[model samples]
Target: MFKKLSIGRDGADAQARGAGAEQRALDYLRRQGLRLVARNYRVARGPSARGGEVDLILWARDGTLVFVEVRARERDAHGGAAASVTRAKQRKVIFAATCFLRALAEIPPCRFDVVAIDGDRVEWLQGAFDVPAEH
Candidate 1:
């Protein structure tokens, strides 16, 4: 005798799709010559603030520290996926990035970037947003 098991197909499919998108984005960045430093850096919550995370941290050949946010959408149904990184999201990313750099003795020149994956197309936006002031 044999038994068959079934799982949540939709949820599993979504996760797999997301993972593929992230990998594709990473490869795209590497091909562009941005050295990969770290991925998915998380910042612990402060006393009065909720913590957040950065998707990717990269180092350029020119010694520039880059904080990257990767957003993936099945399709550009709502002004494209890049447009999804709203002001609130950017602030959270900036906050997390500041926390990350504070732990380092020497802070390098830094920038923000957005990697948007729309289907098979990948768009890399450098200097996507200015570094937010310490709050």
Candidate 2:
């Protein structure tokens, strides 16, 4: 999966690039038969605060709920995008997912996926990472 790592210049421009990458990731997953559940899913940790942002959420072919993180970098400069998902970031995502699950009647099987794009190359890591229990 070769992706040219197309990202915007900086600031809001960079955010737009991130959004674009997310859309591309969503489209790619749709081609693979994943049904979209949500995009840019966010959960707040407080009454007036911000929390983690899940780039994309989808139902997998086997019906497993998927929480996706789309990372687009200019290059694999610092371990690329997949490697950028640190423990702290994982905690945030897990936190958001927990919030999402609370609204469900019955929670389905879930897994975390990452779509790492670096310099025109795309790597889709299924069940890429896990949620730390301590989080």
Candidate 3:
């Protein structure tokens, strides 16, 4: 399933860039045949806990539910886009994915993916991260 996304018209430059990167990643995924399920999925843990957000969720052709994180950088230096997804970031995305799964009637095979945008390059990294053992 697909839905219209209102992105890139925001007031903040960082937000705008993030939205643009998300749009680019979404387009790339679509071209690769992954159908979008949700966008910007978030879970608020309140003052007591760390909250989480996932940039995009999609349904793969193989029936896998994909949770994606989009990262962007002007250059691929100091580890660049993909490297920006640190351990804490992985925890946040995993937390958000857990919340997303709770709403499903039947959970399918799932994996975390990352779309690392370094300048004009877009790299699709499937199984980019996993739920940490403690989670």
- Among all candidates shown, the one with the greatest TM-score: 3
Going through the candidates in the order shown, the clash numbers are 0, 6, 0
lDDT per residue for candidate 3 within 1-135, as digits (tens), equals 899897765568888899999999999999999999999999999675989999999999999999999999989999999999999999899988998999999989999999999999999999999887886
lDDT of model 2, residue 110: 98
Model 2 residue 33 lDDT score: 98
Q: What is the per-residue lDDT of model 1 for residues 1-135, given as tens digits with 9 covering 90 to 100?
A: 888877766887887876677688789889988888888888887895777788889898889999999999878999898999998889889888988899899999999999998877899999999965665
What lDDT is reached at residue 7 by model 2? 68
| Residue pairs in candidate 2 whose N, alpha carbon or C atoms collide under 3 angstroms | 2-120, 3-120, 3-121, 4-119, 4-120, 5-120
Q: Sort by TM-score, best first: what order?
A: 3, 2, 1
Pairs with steric clashes in candidate 3: none
- Alpha-carbon local distance difference test for all models: 0.87, 0.87, 0.95
Candidate with top lDDT is 3
Weakest lDDT window of 10 consecutive positions for candidate 1: 1-10
